[model samples]
Target: MASTTDVIAAPAPAPAKPPKRPPARKMVAWLDPLTLVKTGIRSAISATIGKQADRRLLDALAAPDVKPCDVSVDAAGRPRQELWLDYVSDLGDGWNSTYAVAETVARPSLTLRDETGATHETRGGAVLVFGGDEVYPDASLLAYEERTLHPWTCALRGQRPPPHLFAVPGNHDWYDGLVSFMRLFCQGRTLSGFETCQRRSYFAAKLPHGWWLIGTDMQLESDVDQPQVSYFQELAKQMGEEDRIILCLAEPAWLVSQVRPKEGRSYLENNLDFLEEQVFGKKVSVFLAGDLHHYRRHANPEGRQKIIAGGGGAFLHPTHLPRKEAELADGFTPRKIFPSPQESQRLCWRNLGLVVSNPRFGVLTGLLYMLLAWALSVNLGGANVPQALGLVVRTALSNPGIVLISTLVILGLMGFADRRFGRWRWLVGLLHGLLHLTAAFLIAWGVSHLMGSLVDLPFRSLGRDMLSAALIFVGGFLAGPTIMGLYLLLSLNVFGAHPNEAFSSLAIPDWKNFIRLHIDKEGHLRIFPIGLRRVPRAWKRGETAREPEWVADPRDKRATPPALIEPPIVL
Candidate 1:
């Protein structure tokens, strides 16, 4: 105060910088070596140890005894009268697909028309159900937080009267024995602007107008547990004969049972059949599920609907794969299939570019070729190409390590071969391995000849050896995946085998979809299957605080929005 001479006020502190937003997440590269190994190990553990531990200890400890929740009214205690719901599954894979679906889901309202050209407008669902596999490449706290929660949070942020959330655990969700899933979804926490209401992995909700939705937990395709049965049985006692039920499963066991009769029998008999005959009886009007990553619907003459709408951000599964039966054993045929069989078959052709689609897969194959080449130790300096290849074959057969690797490779391929192929799978897998060996041999020969002609350095010199190794690696990288792609193409198109492998390699970020349902005051349900053909790659921050923090950039060339996959279904 004494320094009155032009006392300059302290310079205003620089305006606090807005918190920098994190970089967007990319889609999972299913063919990445790390992803493959991690998922494979988790699948193995979940199938054996995790399943046992969960059944023996975890379920008993985590099972909730809370009564079924009734959502017949809003939080303000007004009668729902009518309700809307959004169902999405196999989500949490890529940022683009996840955000696209989330954006469509978060919209305040959507208007569309059915095949009859009757226009319909709907608000966002008051309740949102995650059908299954909430996170991809296995579920964990980090995976769920980053891949699932963040995208949804950014999409739904600032919304008023958030939708209630419920989920039934899928195989991936069960990988950690449902610990993270329990903490995130079963604790009644508000997640990403959604109010989670379930106190267990599976839930039952009583909607208005004598309708109920039941979600079941099928751990590793095992039978439904006793406590879950008791829970549902008790809930059923409250239902009247006029009431209709909607059954939600982690898988479509009806289709599974037809496609894979032997293994599918266990799923069908132990889960769907038991529940339908013993507990719910003939009251189930709709059966809904995910896990296949596509949309197909089968409706019986009596108007019962069986639908699989799994196109939720994961790579699309082909719908054209030949099944043992075109219709369910009970004579229910597909009324609608998205990406129709013709379109799905066309998409399968993309697998022919496997190396381009999955570069890391090519790198893994390249390293394997280099290892096999090193084991052979072929010297083609002045030798005939045929002789060099012969040497490779002999050395590969003679080396114990090489032999073991070859055997494992063949057996692994056989394991992946669809059981539909039966005994032919063994031969197919053997041929697949032999073809890879042939590719390595050819690559080795080509590299040796090329290096011999181009460089004058001694064969074993570091410079010459490094150059040769590099050439071998490059050749293997290109040829190995190309051969694999061609094999997959032929296998899927011609022999109808390796359907899962064929499409999974594509890692397609397009053809994402989800379902929206509205139960009208008249007790009629309308099903809307929404499809997004291409996800926007470029995104920009919201211009206003009321908007999501990130949104599809309108300037992006691929900014196509969601549309009806097929005409709406009213039942």
Candidate 2:
């Protein structure tokens, strides 16, 4: 039988043809000044909107009689003592992969059967708990409709008794002041083809088998609003000390290791501590979060677990293989569950899809500029290729700043290599950096000399000559320093000093996965971190069921990358 990990095996078989996708949307022009201005405006307004939203949610949750949604009990009015919960986060993209995963979860046949082959019907109707970032490219009503709501609606089509849905807004969700999120998940609007009853962005649900679910709201770096704090405090007052909790934070606290925490105390860490100590005053069995766009688990000897399951459907992020786990303030080491190095290399090609426009616009534009320079050099400028190279070298020699910066960059690259490969790391890094620097210098040199030669062109008309010279200078500027600047950016991203984050266009070991949480009768929590080889290009509604494909062996401490298994049930 074939395994899920088979996708990562060496000499992979050719993939079958995939179904066609919708018309491609343009990538966000992140570098545009107007785009930055809009982002700033949205961010400034988001704090106010988020604050008001927190108040409304807190008020509703504290209505003195808000009943918790039940999933552990059956129609017989007895405790089934087991529950399975489907958790997906950062799942806003309505791409083929997102569609496939969502459809798989929407089906009732995708249930868990126990060791004795007894089907726990209570676990079959697994409730959906979305973590955050429900949309991409910015949160708007239209984006929610097309990216999130539509795909989800497709997933739930033809389903019997629909599953209950709950969500907390992410940074993207707050971009539009939570208007769309409020309508889709909080308002009377239906989430699973049935009207949604959830009134608050944050929720507290009582599960069977002695498990409690608490979802919190976080808007950027701000504190969890006073109303939210008060509501949790009130809930804590009524709770018994013996109860355990499954806390769901929209952002992962473990990510602080990759990106440095803010100076002084960490707001996220402090919030969790406050909830655990002041509010709940009890044991939090596990912390589940999204926002990092990957699947990772970190645990200590004490059995407390922190898991990031952001691969619900967003573009994947790289695993932090070279990150020094021991240096993290929280001493737990995170173990990546998906996209082994081989798998990462396989999926890296997907990054090209992200940048290339429908008609290859970006590539074509770059080529056009290059060709214009070539034409100017050949027709007007008297400089030859050797002359261009000599001019660039002379200019580089005159600028000590470039020389100093390039040396530092090379050293950083060496450090990066040393962390990943122990022996002769310095030499490898030096050679790697030198190669990139040489290429960048050549590009700058040739373009600048060509521009310099344009000053000598003999034009028939004075006005035409002046215009041509100005354009030539501008083109030269772009080809010279501007091109070098781009090269430095690329170099830093490709071989920079960071471990957790990758700035390169395509992040490798790009993890695309999610998790399923199961609590047994005894209240013990088990997590399944599942990975997809890639989007099931052929996945469609009403497909026949197959063997359960497990991505990682939860019990194995030293499992190799891209673990696989074929159990009886589909997960």
Candidate 3:
């Protein structure tokens, strides 16, 4: 070897650096703005003509009432007084979630055979009640065929006499004016062990013990059409004063109290008020709804229960962080008996990444600003276009402000969105604006330093001039993602995370969930929420149907033995 100092000259050639690859494609392709455009178009159409058009024709359509005897009994000795009803809501997404639902469908009798030895031993043929949203992402015939009908049909596996199918139109189903949903579910075609018996989207199923399962059509954000209201009004008149009814609505209106404290009562609340005061004019047993994509059972002191069971093959919604009773303002007592494994931190962190990185709108926003930074560096050098672009990227990175502002804005919007937590929202806004201002200054400073390293363009305080251009570009390109992220942040925080994840580009593998309502021989309704750990891809996974394992909290007062709330106990 040469002298020690000279040995540096013989340093081995550096290991060949690996070539950088373009960023990997997003996990979910449709989670982009293009899909949003398609859905937005459908939503706009529904808002305009679809809702109005359907209103005029409600009465013209038919709603058939199926009797108790029409459905088979739950077990051997069980009388017709007992009924088994399988309820699924916000269904029509994810293979595993639907697979879980299918397993229960394949073995409908298992629900009737409760562990408590609740003696209803007859062969119970359940009526499948879809709490709307049969198919999703526009609800086209293809969606229904692929996501809804085929999946359920495959699950049935030629089992004789499949459950009778009944559904109300959810917001997603209205995307195509319910045309595809009508054809697949409303039309009388009985393929795949399922039958569509109701010509209209809304119906009232006559249950045992003077009970009625009344479902109404809530078209988009509009009111329940006059026809639906009139139909229910008439039905209410015919029923006796003692008859208790289970009201089935597509949206959870009363849950608004969980989010917005000072907001006025929702349309459904007013409708319920009218129904109790004017229509049925008696004690409404339960108010059941799905749409929030989770399970919640709330009871008022007067015994009225508002149960939300939207966990049917959809990403589960995260429950709101528990706050003070005065802060919640919602009158119902939350039954903590069914505590989901979902945590707020995990939900928010995952959703924030998904919302920002996955959406095409968000990606484009990031890239546009990045490109602008490159462009700002472009005119300064005599270097070729490719070389200039690289320099621009380097300069943008040097500034650090671009990334800083983007992150601050996202965090600020998310942090301040909780209305229940008092007036911290203003602090978020103030800090966000200050950070943005700082970013603008840093952009100019970064330009100056970058130019110093390269050939300077013909301009005085060139970096200062660059600030104006940077601001202009940021104002335009950055505005979209900034605002979009803000909107998503507010919605995710306010809506409590589940709706964001359920409807977003990211797919979270949540536990499979549904509910079984069993009317015992005593005419009491017992609701069991079933949750499965995972989907069994093959039939050999288990011999029997899968059911939920209850996760009881010791702190839950309602966790007394048997867990049955005793029906006619009011919903």
Candidate 4:
């Protein structure tokens, strides 16, 4: 043994390791101002979307735990009254486009006071079921309360005895993650002393009497057939003693727009089958909603009724002009003329259909539309190829300048309704004239596009398009708009309230006028004027005019009962 120490050969003298440099100081964390701005926008958008998703639900009123003593068969199994709510939607100006939200909120109180007067007062307290889209734009409680104040405070307070109020959350309510909606509507208070009931965003409520009000959170999720069906089964089970249950949805588009092609990975249309089978086909007694921002009813060919009452305090919506030439567009059926509903009936039903009440949609305050039109007209010199293309897009999207100007012109055309626009008929005339000029330019641009569609742009056509574009630009720059505004106007006989006195109500019609056209699957170019027609339904996808084919069977009725859902009812 070379010696234990030698054997360890040990530690060749540890080579002096170079002194390790101290770890570098950590960099200070920082936030970019641009990033902060982006975050705020995202937060706001998420909030709005949450409202769209909030479905102030109804609890499963079916209680197997009910004491046997509570059961008493009525002399007649059927309750004395059988109410069928035809349609319900957006009673409170549910959704909001940038244009008309202000008007909706301005007239909140008058909108929500159970206008259709209680169907009937029964021994059991009444169930006031809301179709959906209870709050407009966003589910801001302030907005909801504001709108509710007018309706309830003004008229509903007069009810000898107030009936129970049942509400269904629409997309706007569901938008802000439904937190506010759930807080105000579902969790806050509903029936008197019914605080103990589970405060789920969506649920069912049973009147002391035999009626069951089933409200579904249809907005957060597009197709609610399964949920609706499940509610039915549960209702049927609890319905042993209860009379018929009323199935209410916030938006009627569920059935009509059910077949729409899914856009941006959206499942909106796929659920139509479920809706049709469980709710529509199941013969759910009543349907009510408010998304069209106008009150109207389509008595379902199948006995069920569909109502769209988006006309709460938010804004009004108008039916567009009839297309003279029929062109096949998806979802387009020109209802140039429609039978107007009764004012009282509309009020009772919560639709913005009648002339007694309707908010006006407005235009940009800073002459934005006019300026944009002028820019395109002037810079492009009347119709540059690119400007023409852009104009085509604007027209297709229902150019605002065209709509606003045209509306002014429409008001002028009436010559008789001068009271409405007559206050500034000259100004209105000027605006409409400008609007018409813009419209003509836009139409010409569109025509070029149509021509381009028919024939590839030959060099000559290209040259002509370029020349036209330059002329448009020069004209727009000089005149602030083009000549011959292509626009459509609609009669407001149904929803426009005649102002009996100056400053009686909100001065909207004159201050704001515009249109948003939704060219359906048919070649029908239908306009929903901006201020009047909020186009409550946003992000329309698919061919504007074609009725989609049913990929899935919509009438399949086979399914498990809703009461037996896996999650036990917390209530």
Candidate 5:
């Protein structure tokens, strides 16, 4: 471990030119057709082919030379040593939300009070660690430059001796098989105002006192590769009995294991367990992660901490779901959760307006209804409403394509159902699919009826059929998404299912948070969990040279400052 003076005395690189102001962008609409298709394809490919490719690449290039970079900063002989570091995750979403966090984190100093009203004035971290998912939707050089790098660059433009930056790859970051992540983070490039110094995706950093921060990259929820495991194993050999380790992972497996034990027993969790038992042993005092986009902390009687602080800038995830207790090691439940359950449940109500929140989703449902109508050849002329409805059900059951579509719908819904529900998920999915199918039939019948009443042409007439199809499309567009929204609301609020879908539909840009850690001279680690209730929605160009190009507009009603989510935890 290098001393503090040794770390800072290193020559500073030439400052890069200030980045141009990033264009204002809206929050990612998860249901939008383009977004859905792009992300879906990338995710599918990454899960299949990308994982294999990464394994081959790592085996070829990294396994033979398993040397973990040493970028540790410590105070070896000093009587008083103090270090501040910041950890944020799931960033690179909308402009307003991302900039809100960047500006706050970039500030030179912050004074905040805990619930006990004890004030602490803290300076910005000398080291900044991005937990995971640096870019949204997908990863690419342009996306990183625009969404990730530009914001921070503009925020830390004029600062001298900029902080050092390190990051772990999340699923989104590995969408391109970590091509973009490697170029941006592992090559030792100067990122905006921060300097990057990691030779690989995973890194081990020695902090002041006897603390070690080790970040791991579990590619696409897979096991830790041999190289990464060996790297950490070597680092563990240097640790003394008194030294403590802060293990950073891409996902909070402990939470997952507790919430959905069967599905959560993944190779990543197994790898972590092995590392704890074999390599790091009891030295790992803290486990930090950020796949779930919220803030939660679970601790045990032995003083080990498991924290999830992914609320950097992405859409808010609900923390209100009823999860099983203590399937994790030592039977630990979350000691702290941000946006109290009441508040989270209240926010879920917004999903009821999914038609308004994600109107594009309605378009997709409408298109599906049209396809089903075409397959069924729905016609209302000279037929009673009951007869038309009966034909829809009969044709839907007989048509191979329609049957397959219905099966897929049910299966998709089943997969979307929370794993915690166990076998009940099948019934939930079937009922949910039946509701949509019934809606489609009714919508088809209504459209045909309207066309028949409005025109004298027969049902087979091209003009009448075309007009009917248009009406069906319009009707489906309005009704399908509305039904989905209602279903999500009921499922989440009543059944405690579809928590991700329910909250994602909201695309909420508030209640962002991050973790700030301080290691005192006595080797005690203090954790301050900071949260922002509402991100600034408005901004103005700065007038002075020293100020960032953009600053939160004082007139914006939603511009609330950062505060302690809970009292600081000293360990």
Candidate 6:
């Protein structure tokens, strides 16, 4: 026993170790109070300057002659008094929601040098048409401003502030809260988006052309109420019998076909009966509008010519081309058309349009344009032409008559509805517009299919194409000011691009981090784990995990697993 105890009791020596320091992750910093104050002040100043610049154009629009707007009933039963009309010769419609609406007006002074070493200066009048998506995917007040007001705010000013310039609400205008729009501009019921400014949806001023120029708020009941019918009725009486009427519209309602109801309407079909009944021998000299975003000239009844000048800078909506040889005539419909006696107007619609090459504001920036130009130099001229562009041209060239006719019908109806209805009503209107858009796409596709059949393959199945056609048709329906509005309210980022990239780069979620929130009836949010399956590992001892399964001795005190958790269920 003595020998065993001595052998086990042999002593051991001590060892040296390194001293410990603070953790590397815990470094903190201190900043000067003055440095922080200066930074904050600079930030506030920059923000104020930017906001002032944004509002500059709207502020400049204040005019001396354009009386403070107010809507009042008159002896003549006019809802509002006279106000000047603001017309854009060629500009596109609103921009999609979610984009910064930085509308600005820049008018620089031009210098004219004289022979005597003296210079004469003249101010140029420049008004920016901040439109690309005049009508959003949905009709909403925010969308309208996004689509129109904001982007054009600063750019709408002219040199010396033009003596008389007006801005009218477009189709998207009628879709939102007209009252709010009026309030923003300090306008009144007599002057609304649905109705022309401060007048009975009709404003007139002496134009240089000797002819009486009248601007009517034809759509009194469109989204809200369209005065189109009443406005036209009143206009007819107000105009000198010999005076030429130049109708202005955000959407050329009287110019387009039933296939593309910009304002949720269509025109007399190619249904010869409706055409003859509603459109023949009308007294319109010219109808001008700018919603379609392309440029065109149209022929109408009564020697009237319709002008489409929706060439505002924003984005391009694809235009369809038509095919005459493959024309598929349908039965005619009957309807009454204002300014026309023809009762049986056929809805013969074709597709015609041009996609302007823009340098900014979309996927095709100036750099992209230069790249494409360089690409053109490397590629042949034949290859340089856009395939999509040619497809559009082919449809237009094949059935110019149909395209023009369709455009007329749609434009006419859109104009009428926009003039008559309130913008809020456009939720329904957008559906109708989609139907027409679908028809346009089909027409273009049909022409292409027919041409393809004659050359190499058998005729394609219209049946097979039906479903996709319907989808496209429905897609067209979903696009409008209202939809765009919804996008604006819900979208997490800016316009023209997806929201993910911007937020991801910031390393920030639109909301808080991925916290699972729960709330009781009182409405305060609480965090909770959801859909958890695995039981938590237990550790009774001051350790992070349970003991390993392999233990050296079964009877040892350390053999038991640490209790990190107790009973799994919450009582």
RMSD (Å) of each candidate, 1 decimal? 2.8, 13.0, 15.2, 23.3, 9.1, 31.1
The candidate with the higher lDDT, 4 or 6, is 4
Clashing pairs in 2: none
Error of 6 at 513 (Å): 45
Give the per-residue lDDT of model 2 (tens digit) for 1-571.
Answer: 8787676548878898543443323233332335547776888787676655544555465454445555567657787677777788987664554654565566565444433444333233456788898877578888777777667666666654566677877888878777777777876465546445566767777787557788888766535776677767766655566777788888876564344334532777788778877888646767888877666677655666777778776766655333344444345665544555444434433433423211222332234334333333333234555675565456546666555656775786576552433365688678766654554444434445555556566645565445544544444333433332343333333543322223223322224565666677677666655555545433223332331221122343332222121121221
Name the TM-score of candidate 4.
Answer: 0.41
**Predicted structure with the largest TM-score when compared to the true one:** 1
Candidate 2 Cα lDDT to native:
0.57
lDDT of candidates 1 onward, in order = 0.81, 0.57, 0.57, 0.36, 0.81, 0.30
For residue 136, what is the lDDT in candidate 2? 73
Per-candidate TM-scores read 0.93, 0.67, 0.67, 0.41, 0.87, 0.33
Cα lDDT tens digits, model 4, 76-165, are: 553323221112234443222211232222221211111233221112122234446555445566756644423333222222233334
Per-residue error at 533 for model 1, in Å? 1.5
**Counted clashes in each candidate structure:** 0, 0, 14, 120, 0, 138
lDDT score, candidate 2, position 144? 75
lDDT, candidate 5, 284-311, per-residue tens: 8888899788899988888889999988
Kindly report the root-mean-square deviation of model 1 from the true structure over all alpha carbons: 2.8
What TM-score does model 2 achieve against the real structure? Answer: 0.67
Model 3 quality (TM-score) = 0.67
lDDT of 6 at 204: 42
Q: How well is each residue in 1-571 modelled by candidate 3, as lDDT tens digits?
A: 5776664557779998532421111122345657767877888987787745774264334543422223433336443666777777887776555645664545545523333546332232467788877766677877777676655765665444577778877888988877777677666678567765666777776677666777777777535666666777767766776777777778776664453343444665676667667777655777788876666677766666788777676655555533323321236777642334345434544544543555455555544444444444434324544565465467657766655645565565555444543465556555545444444334434444555565445656656456545654544344544544444455455533323432343444354456667676676776666555444332222222332211222343421222222222323
Candidate 2 regions with alpha-carbon error over 4 angstroms? 1-41, 44-67, 72-78, 110-125, 260-265, 327-331, 341-380, 385-504, 507-511, 538-571
